[model samples]
Target: MSAVLLDHHRLQYLHEAVRLGSVRAAAEALDINASVVSRQIALLEKELGLSLIERLSRGIRATEAGALLVERFRKWEADQADTVAKLRELQGLKRGHVDIVLGEGFVSDLMSGPLGRFWLRHPDLTMAFDLAGTNEVVNAVAEDRYHIGLVFNPSADPRIRVATASRQPLCAILPPGHALAGLNRPLRLHELVDHPLGLMHPSYGTRQILAMAEAAERIALAPKLTTSSINVLRHFVKSGLGLTLLPAFSIAADLADGSLAAIPIDNRLLSSSEACVITRRGRELPHAAGQLLRFLSGQMRAFRAGEPAAKMKPRATRR
Candidate 1:
């Protein structure tokens, strides 16, 4: 391959290789031979004057440079799709694609039931999900990352159309053996100041809620553990590390199983808020995004209807 040549195919290969971690697996996905995939990677490395990946015992790993390239190309791929969608939309086509950018929390719960059904009903639409923080969500949509983005506790932004999906109340996640494991009544935020707490990363929506609590009480919480995965945070709480603070819906499974407890925070620290669909100004979504939007809307409605806030009692399912 020529040094100046930039092939989207090569970019796709690198991205897939990174995600699947196996040239053979990636080749299988692309329906090509492993040797062909290896040759393409070699060409890519030669063009960049650096190895993009290394063969691991079980799979492969991207070099730092390779990782950066792959991430950038992910955006590039998205941009190409957007361009195609827009050009068609300009030519008497109101359908092309729908980019449904969402946070990890929404991915876990709101994506499947109703939203998935919506996708099935709309065959002409296509959709993609991007995960990022509030600022990134706003920026990406502003920069046309996807037709729409989901923002948690979204602040004012000129980049995209924002909507409120849900305003959930912050709650405490307690472990099984904890004395407060069975309580469902609202509790004060300051009450948890002394107890060990597990917190999410500063970039996450949950982190913003905790920050508000810290500012209101004029104190900072020194968590025993901090993480990105809400599930892992719940796991730590279940393991007796500490408690966590987030909206009631985020940990519905844990609460139902009695492995964790959700207690409302009465300190008025944060009004629980999370991601919702956002579309850029002057941007018309493709068939996929519109389908996804209706899907997500339905999902959110069903979520509100089926998942209710009830006091959970400690059950035998406690882990």
Candidate 2:
């Protein structure tokens, strides 16, 4: 009947309540009274003439409308932060924050040089890194929750844009004295069948690509160990428990230090896997974030062409 206008304060209350899953939790986060949050959200619902939240047995859940609103509010917050950062840039003030979500496999490469170099060049800029699987990385970037995403063999998504990509094939990681480590040439997928194998969880892009290769080669691989941690997989092999599959760049330090050996896989799909830097399809990143994205694309070992020097060496049997 009457024109309705939403209040920013009320929207914030609703956002926090939905995010934290309870009014009391939201109140604790905001350092306010629970009643205040509930009252404000109720007022927001009244104004919108729609229920924004539904109380569950233990907590609360946002209605579909509320979820949509919350998503918009999050995007609005991100845009506002980006706008302020851009304005600061125009004033020659070098201060901004960038958030990135990436697969664990990229951690070694990112920390080895690219992250440090970027930090040295832009001392005032801050960055946050969250480790996730490829699917989570894609969703975070697409939803504007993160500025950049580093993924391996990411699935095609209309909401994602590949900023840069490099061919970084998945390789079988073997312990120095392991039989597979003595292979002078690329290892075939079927060759790993009899060995104790460790694999990343199916959620990871690495596992997804491996699955495709298995299907293509008409071989089913049943790994003895399945885990979500990349480090765990590395350790699984290092302990001589089993061999695992990962990109050579993922274990560059291990390879260089002779702690592990990575043999290229012969599967066509495995060889075609690429490490990619992605962003939201049409989103304009902040100045600092954009610069970091470009820096990573050019500097990260995973995004660079060719294998690491350790992987290029001739394989030798341990005495």
Candidate 3:
């Protein structure tokens, strides 16, 4: 074989030509001109000392040797694709899709704060958001069904990697015209139970927060409305459905708009109820995900310190 015959460009042209069925089609698929593809294929055929493709009246067909070459090159191309995929997964800055399984509360409040900002930092990493419950998040991450998971006090997975993304005190979200719209100070948990409360569905992070509140109070309190959607919950609260408790950031817009008020719950119960970040243990986070995690860690310091939300690291060779 000639030194010039074994080039990647030539081999790539041949493979694409066979796969695409014609020189013009291959060039179109490869975003190159037909002449360039034809020239490269000619060079490749000359190097192999055989015609790989036959120009038929309509289009083209591969010869016997060409068919074999296609088979071999197809495997090589598949391997090349696998190599590219794995490399992209490693760099954490590759053009790959990420499926993020987080709770509805998280997608409502925290994602826009830290995670949204991280999207601007890394544009190549596209994220698909799935609003899941604590149980769902825990199960998906433990089973490697999702790339990253943001959840609450679910049992830890030995096979999962955990990080504390953000720690915000659960605050009360009251609809307009409610008696406790804006109190002078944070209301006590018992005081909160006095009114019919809106809570998330069972097994959700919000429900966990409610359970903790109930456990602290040592009583079972039924919710006025139970749901798995933050938007629906917010709408219910806004439409005078009932007062629900959520992270302060989650109700920021409603708070600002006078439709809802955030009654601070940074008490002992709130301190114990944390949205622990969880993922598959050994997997590396993408660039945006890592940056977002860093921002969450920093911003959440204020929460642990009992201060208000103010602002918005790596395990391996992450970029």
Candidate 4:
């Protein structure tokens, strides 16, 4: 093996080639000619005495050895970035980036205040906020695509470590002056079935739980309007079309301002939801992200402590 072949340039070329899956595509992405990219990859293979890629009609794919090396290189790159973040922390937290992806439900009043305060404390720090579904957020964090994740009712997986979690029960959302608005007790699942229903799409965390309840009771749910967006469900509810089911945090402001009525559900399966803050298992987060995570944990704790419990009627007949 030639010592020159172990340099950063050759390794970078190999990484790009595997990532883009074609020498020509890698060259285009890197703004270099195809010949330069192919020559470096050939030299790398010669030095290692192994073919790194297999050409195909459409593009190229990495050999097993090449794939393993690229995986290691990515981990090494992450470790180097962590080291730099730590060094910046010693320099007084002047500058760093925190990448966070959360469920769209969190974009509402749930996170606005705490995140605003976090930014105020570190004006020089940068953060990127992305909205995705709960499961997608969990997957993104587990894959190390983001430093922090906030999601609802995520699956039990070994790849993610939950830093803070709060159990939030499902609530029945009713428009102001609706017939059910005056009830202080928990509403039964059967009680809500007769009303016109506007449900979040099946992909949402709440809808998943609702589906379980429907099967458990041998009942069918016929939503008059189905949408993937929470805002659309809220809009439908506000227009007096039908009641929608949501976790309490999503309608906190609406309930507070007398615009909506939030009733707790009495059923066991749909009684509550879990809101979690997660990070990749065994991976140390960057300093900026870590600080924000701690702050978020505290905020969740305080919110849970201060939030009122669901009002439920005593169990008797199903109705």
Q: Which candidate wins on TM-score?
A: 2
Best by lDDT: 2
Deviation (Å) of 172 in candidate 2: 0.6
| Model 1 clash number | 9
lDDT for position 279 in model 2: 91
The parts of candidate 3 lying over 4 Å away from their true place are 1-84, 89-94, 110-117, 285-319
Winner by TM-score between candidate 3 and candidate 2: 2
- lDDT per residue, candidate 2, 178-222, as tens digits? 776665777778999999999988889999999998999899999
Query: Which has the higher TM-score value, candidate number 1 or candidate number 2?
Result: 2
Model 3 scores worst on lDDT over the 10 consecutive residues at: 310-319
In candidate 3, what are the lDDT values of residues 3-40, reduced to their tens digit? 54267777778777876688999899889999998998
RMSD of 4: 4.5
Question: In candidate 1, what are the lDDT values of residues 1-319, reduced to their tens digit?
Answer: 3447678889888878887899999999999998888899889888878889989999999999888887678667666776786678678764555666666656656643665666566556655777776667777776565677765666667756754365555667787567665454555666787888888788776787678768977877888888777777767887877788766566666666666767656565464444456776656556556656655655663235324544443211111
| Every candidate's lDDT | 0.68, 0.87, 0.66, 0.76
lDDT of 4 by residue, 1-319 (tens): 5554365676777788888788888899889999998998898888889888889988888899887777666666667778899997888868999888987677765465877787789888898999888677877777567889988777788989998888766778887677776665677788888899888766667888788888998888789888778788788889988998877677666666677767777777776567788998888988788898998877652236336533322221223
Name the better of 1 and 3 by lDDT: 1
TM-score against truth, every candidate: 0.63, 0.86, 0.60, 0.77
Error of 4 at 104 (Å): 1.5
Model 2's TM-score against the true structure = 0.86
- Deviation in angstroms for 264 in model 4? 0.8
